[model samples]
Target: MKNIFSPIEQIDNLDAKVIAGIERLATLFKSSLQDTAKRYKLTPLQAQLLIFIAEHSTKLCSVTMLAKEFSVTKATASDSLKTLVNKSYIEKVYNPDDARAFSFVIVDIAKPMVNELTHFGLLMSSSLSSLNENELIQLCHLNLKMLNIFSQSGLITCRMCYSCQYYQQKNGGFYCHLMKKELPAKALRLDCPEHLKSS
Candidate 1:
């Protein structure tokens, strides 16, 4: 009997190779990130958050929201947030909408640190010069698709790049308008870690 709803073979041998290559890419990036982060005294998670905040400086972000987005416990997020706050990397903001809530804005002084991470993308692109544009495009498409699949499957919850937010480009990249005054990149989070979501 013919199977009416059999699954199709989407990933073939070549696809497997591509997947392997993607895994290699991730490993290499992670390794490099760890080394770079160690030199700068930051963890991979911190680097990710720093980049996010630097790129989205204009927007407001909360530790609770960050915890949920990163699939981390609120306590973990708060702990990490506290470290950043103490280090003068991220500042906290109070919410006018709800005094009980707070938001985090990145400091411009940390731009140099953020730029270090950006350099990785440049390095990778230059190293993979042999790969044609179309191939690179295909790889990006597939990788994004795979990420979506994982996120949808509950492997991850969020996949947003803070830099891609709307507010970052505004306010000269510091203290999103939500804050009463222009706070430094590492102003101070309110007692609470809840506030409005920013771009």
Candidate 2:
């Protein structure tokens, strides 16, 4: 087979190389998830839905929320959720606040599999072992910056506090400009309900 990234090397630009690297990394990550999902007789989408519901708070696990989070149509999210429910990987419960909406929760049978999937870092950690702690931190910061850019461009959506327009830093202290309050570093949310796209 031809090398898909070979043309990237011939581009003679750092941006091209960086974009190609990100694309290649995403492909590899998807392949890893596909392999793992196959072992459990689930599609990658189903596995992703299971993991998302397991990680997020109950209030955020509705089908509409899943559709928004995954950038998929509501019908697609509903189909995936139905499959997970059929497999006993997740169950839907009536939402107290919304009569028409239901919230999802991972079933007990799926907890162990979800836990195993959450260790995905272990698969890639060895490859990053050569980097020093400072280098790792720098890489993380760069990745987060890229994520913010992608989110702002509408190429992606991220609910991380760092990606929100309200997130601000002054004098080495974090704050939510929208809420007009300081936030502890440890309290920054990974999936915030009020996340707004940063300009």
TM-score per model over all chains: 0.65, 0.81
For every candidate in turn, the CA RMSD to the true structure comes to 11.6, 3.9
lDDT of 1: 0.63
* Model 1 stretches astray by more than 4 angstroms: 1-21, 57-60, 158-199
- Shift of residue 163 alpha carbon in model 2, Å: 3.8
Q: Write the per-residue lDDT of candidate 1 for residues 1-199, one digit (tens) a residue.
A: 2232222332344555655666678898888777777777888878777776666433336886677666788898888888888899888888788888888888778788778866777887798899887777666555555664665566765432222122233366434344434534333232222343233
lDDT of 2 by residue, 1-199 (tens): 2343678463676676787789989898888888888888888788888888988787678888788778888999999899889888899899787788789999998899997775665878888999987787668767767786877777666787787889988779779988899986556665687877576
Best-fitting candidate, scored by TM-score: 2
Candidate 1: lDDT of 143? 55
Best by lDDT: 2
